[model samples]
Target chain A: MTSSKILPAMPLLAAGLVATPALAASVTITIPQVKVAEYHRPYVAGWLEPVGGGSARTVFVWYDVKKGGREPGTKWLADLRSWWRKGGNTMKLPANGVSGATRAPGSYTVPIPANLPAGQYVFKVEAARETGGRELVSVPFSVPAKGGSASGKTELGTITIR
Target chain B: MRFRTVLIAAAAASSALATPAMAHRQWLLPSTTTLAGTSEYVTVDAAVSNDLFYPDHVALDPAAVKVWAPDGSEGKVENPSKGRYRGTFDVAIDKPGTWKIGMERSMIGGTFKLNGEQWRVGGRRPPMAPGAARPSGAAPAGAAPAGAAPARAPGAPGSAGGQAGGQPMRMVASVAEIPAGATEVKLTESLSTYAIYVSADAPTKGVLTPTGKGLEFDPVTHPDALVSDEEAQFRFLVDGKPAAGVKVTLVPGGKKYREAEHAQELTTGADGMVRVKWPVAGMYWMSATTEDAKPSDKRASARRMTFGSTLEVVAP
Candidate 1:
């Protein structure tokens, strides 16, 4: 959810608390185009794992949330094996400001959480495609980081953290 | 038939034989290699066919198959059924780590000489007639003949150590059964291992530990977490030691749909490691065989060991 939309709905006090920071951290993810007989949009999960040792924090989950059926696309969320093991299994569905629908093959830039304490951290992004493949890439950076980038060979493309 | 044509074309790169259908390729294919839930089930298909992963020749025996849980305990095969072409079974994975499922069989059989006579001791199959169809209900399905390649044990019963063409033979189980004072006797021990790995939540190490016997697969890269883009390193061990110069053959699945086998033949290095860079993402069958004089038993002079597994690799 964009801050402009939420800003108008919140009261004066809550709006001040939820206001976007001047220099918010952002991540740009590129979903690559895969050639195959059967290609389904990859389910992607982004999270942060402490470099030293701590619980993982989910940043975003991109999937077919509104997929029509008794069983939604959430059933396949576990296909993102790495993220599910790290922290996804504990998260509730349709988390506000973090859950969204799947996207096409292209680049997307989204804001990252700015509340992390000053310390080393590793940002992880995992994508899994039905009848295709799975790929996970990690980028290490410190709180108030300037930037970092990593690339995936198959299911995902280049990922940049700012 | 069209299938025969494809098989011949696919096998051309590997063998010089005009009709390569006589030799069977055995494999066990799991439904999924990695899963997420607490208690998920994985279905597996077993067969010995001309084409890899295509079940057309014979079904494997479920009795010979075993499952090892992620915790290193024996698991159960929930439902098993043998069809005319393949065998199917389901394993309930209730743990979080990886599980190993497949078959391991060993037998002691070889040529023995006694009083100027050479006798074949293992089970034998009557060479199938050219273009013969599936045999009727005479032989039991998936029963390994007593004294042959345990990997081929699921084959139908045939002449047991019986003379095929004026060769005197005796069907016996062990070398001890041979008469005493047998001169110039040579015996061989054959061991075969076939397996597949499936992970529930994450890949673990408990089931991947080497037994240090026969042929062992020690993967530097986890078997269940392999990706086609990166090279995977695996070590082969013979009698708990590095098996250098061992030939490893890796063939991708879906031979029925392709013209070439696309098989990669790699030899183990001094550390018994072979690096595999897969050409594509899908299921693959890998096998390695070695023959040495290190027999576990004194009765056997030579030992033959084979290790095979079906692996699924992801895109990245």
Candidate 2:
């Protein structure tokens, strides 16, 4: 394990870290619990916006996918107005991975599809609760054509590029 | 049961009602979630009113609204108009993709109602509810009317405390102060968020992957491959691990789908996955959420998480 001859190459490897994990790009977002008086599950959505292009790749959306009716229920989606603006509202039914029900407070991993284009992209996550407030956090990561890696902070944490 | 206990308990259990118990829903009704191509136009119906059953519309300030393009470009509202319980505006899709058009994250508030009227109790004024009072940047003092106006002002701590059964008076507390022994004060602060998407030349794929936020849902399958009458499976990622027992909902897509009494609701398996039968045609939206009963810090109300998305199913 201790090859002095290859020690110098370690620096190069460190430099290349950012260019690694192209197929392994993944993120584990953690929602820290806040001790408030009132609590309700939030409406959450995450997406990837291309650096300069006009397209976005959705990570996932968790909400009351089945709680809406024509009357007063369909209106709760507005609790996450920002996500709604960014395609959260269009995801109405289940398509396997794109949408689902809300998860408990914990760390959730969003696996970047193995085949992702390389370029500058922003990993964004937004959360909103019925009585609770809303928070949107994002971090920018670069995807080298072959591989890459990077990390994020503020609502989002531990982003890995495989 | 000295009403004070209920108020304090509610505050302590802030998770009781998703928002301030009852808030008039101010919403944005979009004409279409997606556009066919670039340079397309979409209309949105917005209002700030208690339109629950009323046909009236109330106008939201045009300056308070902004339309965000797919590339994050900002557009000001145009052709602004107002009606009973509603307001309306139109914007052109400059770039191809989903556009986010909604009101700015400004606070809308009003005086807290105590026993049916704006009042105060022992040393504390009532909570100021947002989204029901004057718009942002407006003076909060004059929001109360002349006759029913509050007798005292709020914004400081350690104010003089009144006795039990104190007269109902209009008053508000500052951000720094929480009432000492409030018998009854409705917890204030309500937020309404609405999102919808459309297909602008078939949804494109990019680096839009999960960045590991608090809660996330990712498509293990190719999102674009979801088609009509096909069985698709999804996985739930909570804190980066497979989430289990989370409730996921799938609703048929259509203008009246919200009225469909028979939407599908299911839970993720132990491995954080769920299988569903895709509809034959039309658009579909899926949503899921989970919450933490115990919050982490005092600054937070409660840790609530939600997710929603849309897909296109071809006709059989």
Per lDDT, the best of the predicted structures is 1
Stretches of model 1 off by over 4 angstroms after superposition: A1-23, A27-42, A48-58, A62-75, A81-162, B1-23, B124-169
Residue B137, candidate 1: alpha-carbon lDDT: 22
- Tell me, by TM-score, which candidate is best: 1
Please provide, for model 1 over B1-316, each residue's C-alpha lDDT reduced to its tens digit, 9 standing for 90 to 100. 6554444333321221111233567778999887755556889998877678898866776776999998878999978998877889999887778899988767666666545656555433333334344423222222424344322322222223323335433333445445454556677777778889998765788987888888888889988878788899999998788899877888999977888999999999999999999998899988887778888879788877778889988765
TM-score of chain A of 1: 0.84
| iRMSD values, candidates in order | 4.1, 12.5
TM-scores for the candidates: 0.70, 0.39
Best by DockQ: 1
Tens-digit lDDT track of model 2 for A11-104? 5446555654435666555665656788766666677888797767667776666664332233455345455545554554444676666656
Model 1 residue B293 lDDT score: 88
